[model samples]
Target: MNSSMDLLQNYIQSFGYDWLSNVLLITTGSFFLWVIWRLIYGRLEALADRTQLAWDDLVIKAVKAPISMLIWVWPATVSVGLVLATHSNDDVVWLGKIDLILVISTFIWISLRLISNVEAHVLDQKKRDETTVQAIAKVARLFFVTIGILTIMQALGLSLSGLLTFGGVGGLIVGLAAKDLLSNFFGGMMIYFDRPFKVGDWIRSPDRSIEGTVERIGWRMTIIRTFDKRPLYVPNSVFSNIVVENPSRMLNRRIYEKIGLRYDDGDKIDAIVDEVKAMLEQHKDIDATQTLMVNFDAFGPSSLNFFVYTFTKTVNWARYHEVKQDVLLKIMAIIKKHGADIAYPTQTLKVDPIAMARDAEQPVGIVER
Candidate 1:
């Protein structure tokens, strides 16, 4: 091996082709790097596929491009450095700077890809909403990319303090001018973290009279589709200030009704209450976990009043209405079977016929009583 190395060195020196030797060296190094990357990455990929954790797959995927860049770009940079070595040591120094820039750029690329992959994995797992995931990933990419740019600038020997000062001054000015936009941006961030509501959720704010399904949550505004199918674009800042009710989070749909029984059939009020309570308790749609109240709550002027309060196990509007209808019909059946009737509003007035006749006679003759 020693003799072979000596012979090869002599051949290169004799031909004055030192650059060719460096090219050969770069090629050999790149080939080994490529082989190692393939072996390691292939095993990791197989292992990731076997695991239930999707993030490992994302990690493997995110690593691939950076390794590939190193395998390809690093050797090229080294070859460039070798070629420049003969020109001037100063030229080789500049090559090192270029290599530094390339390395930072590659790092930024990997960072962005990692963010995207991990966010996508989380979205697939539904740990957060698509809107929140996308927003967070965008922010992460911007942050890392900014860092990479600053790093490249530092490597290029630019003064960071001056640039930062100028940027700060400009940012202050822009921030003052676009305060509303900044508010909306921060409001969107709040939604991401606080998670008051999500896309496809039904939300209503009583104070704002805003009720709709969330269609999209954007950087500046949230798009809501009303029941009439109109799209309502609301600023993200509005959600921060308003009291939003998320009915989608409710475990059950409520049913509240007041039934009036006739005064004469009040004897069946206790039986009616018992029947209604039994009906609610045995109803297939009623949620047994919550409080069920059926009692004769009040006595109206014209009738006996009872209140039925319960919750349905389902929150679907159509199904809830169906369940409500069934319970109501059953209540009516129980009332009818118990020989009681639902009361209606009525009024009566007492009149004195004798006094009316006397007044009529006196008004016609006014002279004598």
Candidate 2:
């Protein structure tokens, strides 16, 4: 490498372009670096694809753009420093500062990209909760960004101790000015830690008209897709105050129903109740371990009312309804098997023969005229 560089320098000097020697050398070096990067990138990606571990692939992807930028940037800066060296030491000093800034920025960019890659990888597995992964990603991004800014500031000859002191005072004012923003941020943090509901979970708030499947959880808000396909942007702070019900996490879905039979079939209530209870116990979908009840609950004004209370093994909304429908149909069949019928609202009237005769005798004279 030294012999080749010397040969190139001698050739440039022979052309009486010794002033452009550094520029040509820098361009040549940058071009070679670009060529090298292109040659290795494809091989690295192919190798990463064959491996089980994802860190290698993530690293390769994260470094690609930064490395590409650095190849040209480092060379150009070095060439500029060499040119400035002959003029003023102060000019070279600024160039060094520029290089330091570029290095810090590149590091920051690579770190952020790696974080994003990791987040995508975890989500693709479909195992971890997306909300949790995103939360972690956000925290990581914030941490890296803060560190990078502070680092660059220090590299630029800024005093860290004074900055820290100023930050401590400014933070209080910023906190007060952005109270709601901070509350929402902390609310989001609480959600990440407590995890009452996650992305894709069906959630509803009893205290408010919030009912939807969670789509995304951000630092200040959560996106929810409602049943009607409407998108709801809910502030995270609101979740901290409401009673949220996560139906998606339920162990079983309840089935409660009231069945009324005709007063004439009152005698068959015991038999029907007993058979219903037995049916529920034998049902594959119904959870026998839960509170199951089929009993003659009350005597309606014109009917004998009974209630069926049970829980289904399935928490799926559609499947639970199907099971409920089957159970209801079975109950109807049992009622019919016992020659009984379901009750409806009705009334009865009775008349005395003596009162009817008295009314007929009093109205006869007007009819004759």
Candidate 3:
């Protein structure tokens, strides 16, 4: 052992300390790193299996322990090996540079894994009611990527001040080029914070109207799947600018309808109004707190028109329709019971061609030749 050590020392000395120290250091560091990695990874895998938490499972899935080990161990081994073998000479400068790169890369990888874990955790929490979680996740990812890029630049020996100066100029140019993109990005943030609507909400805008369930909130747009199974992509900018009507948020939906009666049936208007109000009051879905008004709204050319205005407690289309149908059926029954009749527009006219020709031939009370 003593002779082996002496021979190793002599060989290392003759070969120039830089090369020999690097080799020895790298080999030793790699061996130890492998042992530690195997032990830690095995234990973590076991722990992950025993835990019932889904976020832990996500962590295991997001990060490949073997790949992480390789990335972390290799550069550290080479850096230490070169420093020990060459006594920190210029020949190992390349190894230092590689080491810096590796460190930056590892940090990025770990940060990504951490972000994934955070997203998983946030999704797991049921109390986070906003559907904008996906938008939030995207913003977080961008932030982490920016940090990673800055770290890599620093590792490359680039001064942060100069890099930041260039980045500011580049950002201005890029922002100008992607004005719509910036609008969308800020719009997404507004959507998340302002929370105009949420997933599963039915919304309508002035220009665009659709009854859909919000599918997902993305970084630039919000996706909605209509009842007909068509996907709608609405830009966040438009959402911020447009008037959004969220039907789902309404406590009740107002319904206004008109029914016409024969002009001769004007005497029955008061009775019809009373019957309609009774029918509305008996409706299961009608809001009792709302004023059910039946008023004589118009005198048409051939009919006496009355209007019924009420609110339905439920916003569901089918349920509202069902309630309206029941009310109409009740109204019809009441009208028939009272022997009253609805009216349709009609007209009568007379023509006298002979009399019109005689009148044209001579003025009234004047003699004609």
The top-ranked prediction according to lDDT is 2
The digit string of per-residue lDDT tens for model 2 on 180-254 reads 999999999999999999999999999999999999998999999999999999999999999999999999999
Q: State the C-alpha lDDT per candidate.
A: 0.84, 0.89, 0.75
Tens-digit lDDT string for candidate 1 (1-369): 224333443454455567877678668878998999999999999999999987788878987988787778766766665565556666345656776787788888888889988887788887666767777787898899889989999888899999899999999999999999999988988987888888889999998969999988888898999999999999998888889999989899999999999999988899989988998999889987799999998889888999999999999989999999999999999999999999999777898999888888885546775
Every model's TM-score? 0.69, 0.89, 0.72
Pairs with steric clashes in candidate 3:
17-85, 17-86, 18-86, 21-85, 22-81, 22-85, 26-81
State, as a TM-score between 0 and 1, how close model 2 is to the true structure. 0.89
Clashes by residue pair, model 2: none
Which should have the higher TM-score, number 1 or number 3? 3
List candidate 1 segments past 4 Å from native.
1-56, 65-99, 127-139, 215-218, 228-231, 282-291, 297-304, 316-318, 343-369
- Give the lDDT of residue 253 in candidate 2: 96
- 1 versus 3: better lDDT goes to: 1
Model 3, position 318: C-alpha lDDT score: 87
